[model samples]
Target: MVMATTASTAAPTSLSSVTLEVADIEAARRFYTAFGVDTHIHLRASGTQSTGFRGFTLALTVAGPATVDSFVGAAVDAGATVLKPAAKSLWGYSGVVRAPDGTIWKIATSAKKDTGPATREIGEVVLLLGVEDVKATKQVYTDRGLTVAKSFGGKYTEFAAGQSSPVKLALYKRRALAKDLGVPVDGTGSHRIVLGGTADAFTDQDGFVWEAAASPAPTPS
Candidate 1:
């Protein structure tokens, strides 16, 4: 059975916020604030570190490196590996590490900026697929007329379906994805699919439900 914790109906039309796990809330707070991310909300408690933005929320709960290591274990067991490990980068981003689930996230402070962008540009959208074999999945998509945009070893691969806008579909090892989503591995694939407008989620292979949409909801629609 697939369970969705939030009421979000679709994969966000545009990239909203990416969450990260941090070891020190105060340090993480200072980093992002310095980076110029508008910190609209901040909470420090025994079990939670949550922040809100205009369109999204980022949560950083207190956990030890072992917890993160355990998460890595879960991901590996599910057939994925750490793309990057938890470390403090000179660039000012700090977090435990990154996983091969098609998204790169970090826990760190925001960089200092003189001006904020009036609007954000849309970037490539990513999808994580759980397939029987990485080679076979890549072949199938390629055979279906999709082109390989990039490949991260045999564990992660991206496909370009040649959409006019910047969008791409990705395939990843399922176990790693389930770990990233903090869910149990049922050996099925994603449940949500994203289109061009009004995002909606649907159940797909292996009862994995995902969210998709054409674009972000209009302001007054």
Candidate 2:
């Protein structure tokens, strides 16, 4: 015999897609295309007012330092303002760039040396939210059925978005994250980001909205 589960008892939700709200869709598309991340990130135009740091950043993890340089250079050429120039840190080599659309992006790699020449390859895309209270926000997501993959006190928490999901989710302290991205901590109005996943639609502790999962694009026949 087998048992069936109800909607209330279903498995935890996983992050499926990330949509960034931009003022100009065409311009954003052009910038992302030049930056070589257009395929991974979704963009939509909105008149929603936003200022300063959007309280979030999308990080791209690549193979090595050379790859990091490649991405940073491309992003800079695409009109992205460099927040933190690519440099070797204790944990890895990384750089931060503010997209023309007002979204902050971080390009990083764990390996200090390149095994080979740089290529236009991205390993992981992580959506990191800057929350006022990490512990409370993490609990809210956990209660909403998101599994925690890594946690460290109230400083940081990362959720397991499953292997097949397009984006990964994580949380960090607002001030700390701002310092890491080389931006001011203060901001107002919309976060200007929408997350799509399997979980029921609802806003999180920091006003980040999650809607129903976005359907995958049709394959070429």
Judging by lDDT against the true structure, name the best candidate. Answer: 2
Candidate 2 CA-lDDT value: 0.84
Task: Please give the distance, in angstroms, between residue 187's alpha carbon in candidate 2 and its true position after superposition.
Answer: 0.5
User: Which stretches of candidate 2 lie above 4 Å from their native place?
Assistant: 1-12, 216-221
lDDT of 2 at 88: 95
Per-model TM-score, in order, reads 0.36, 0.91
Question: Weakest 10 consecutive residues, lDDT, candidate 1?
Answer: 50-59
Q: Which has the greatest TM-score?
A: 2
Model 2 agreement with the true structure over 1-221: per-residue lDDT tens digits: 11122234443477777888988999898899899887776887899998787899999999999999999999999899999999999998999999998899999999999899999999988999999889988887777688999999999999997665777899999999999999999998899998876655777768888777646331111
TM-score of 1: 0.36
lDDT of 1 by residue, 154-219 (tens): 787866534332334566776665554444454222221222322344333233333343333222
RMSD of 1: 13.5
Candidate 1 lDDT score at position 57: 13
Error of 1 at 214 (Å): 13
